[model samples]
Target: MNILKFQHEEDFAATGANLIASLLQSNPRAVLGLATGSSPIGVYAKLVEMHRKGMVSFARASSFNLDEYVGLPADHPQSYRSFMNEHLFSHIDIDPARTYIPSGNAADLDAECRAYDKLLEEQGPADLQILGIGSNGHIGFNEPDASLSSGTHVVDLLEETLEANARFFDRLEDVPRQAVTMGIGGILKAKQIVLLVRGEEKAEAVKQALQGPITTQCPASLLQSHPNVVVLLDEGAAKWLK
Candidate 1:
């Protein structure tokens, strides 16, 4: 694990974008494992700026998002798909056909999860996987638990997760109660992992995830076992690193 701390959020976002830009430059067809959350929004914005400046291009790259809300339509305002489109995809030259996000409203969600895992088997071992740490140390929608899944699957959103995400919805009740996410095993398969964390609120989670014990109770702690993991943090989030 390599930890990089920045005093400002802008620097953190720029560093994260630079990493992705370097990957795309080296491999035009790089498979990106993307995450959707506030932590990554600034990074995505920086990428968009780079694309506009011709400093990087995603035309040949493919992307796979980490998770999606189970009961939301792809077109829904708060859906991960929409979030990606509005934040990154639409601003770049990437082909929409190559981008994949689990079908949150698929008639048979179990089948959808299976298909996603199969697709990963065929086109994965992602060149770079982006992640954000939840307040409870969860990654994707893989909340802390006694055990974790090895492939893509559905998950019941925890109260903390629901409350954290409620800010995006009109009402707390509007947040989805469930979601579909790539399992920790699936996430670990990536060739590289980039964890982006910000805010003073996430300080403790970052400390536990990076310097604490490896356990299923804190899903992010499992990244300690990954061979190639880079953690980018702002001053607030990296406060406990020392």
Candidate 2:
């Protein structure tokens, strides 16, 4: 684990974008494992700026998103696919056909999960995976539990996750109770993991993930076992670590 802490938001976003830009520069066809949420917004914005300036390009890159809210239409404003398009995809030159995000509203959700797992198995093991930590210590939607799933699957949203995401919806009830997420096994297959964490609310979770014991109850702790992980933390998120 390589932990990098930043006191300034600009510095943190810049460093995160630089890492992706460097990866693309070396491997134009790099496979990216992407995540959605507040933690990565700044980094995505920075990447957009770099793309506009010709500092980086995603013309040949392919991407796989980590998760999506179950029961939501792909065109829904809050859907992960929509989120990616609005934030990162639309701004870059990456081909939409090559970008993969699990279908959350498929009639046969079980089959959707299986298909996603199969697709990942055939075309994945992303070169770089960008991740964000849930306050309850989840990575993707793999909530803390006695044991974690090894492939793509559906999950019930925890109260903490629901509350944290409620701000995005008009009411908490509007938030979906389930999600489809790439499991720990798929995430771990990435050649490298880039963990982006911000805000004081994530302080303890970040601490537990990086310094605490390896346990499924704190899902992010699993990253501790990965061969390569780059943890990027803003001051607030690193409050406890300091």
After superposition, the stretches of candidate 2 with alpha carbons farther than 4 Å from their true spots are none
lDDT of 1 by residue, 1-242 (tens): 99998987789999999999999999999999999999999999999999999999999999999999998999999999999999999999999999999999999999999999999999997999999999999999999999999999999989999999999999999999999999998999999999999988899999999999999989999999999999999988998876
Candidate 1 Cα outliers beyond 4 Å, as residue runs: none
RMSD of each: 0.7, 0.7
Query: What lDDT score goes with residue 57 in model 1?
Result: 91
TM-score for predicted model 1 compared with the true structure = 0.99
Global lDDT of each candidate: 0.95, 0.96
Question: How high is each candidate's TM-score?
Answer: 0.99, 0.99
Error of 1 at 77 (Å): 0.3
For candidate 1, the 10 contiguous residues with the lowest summed lDDT are 233-242
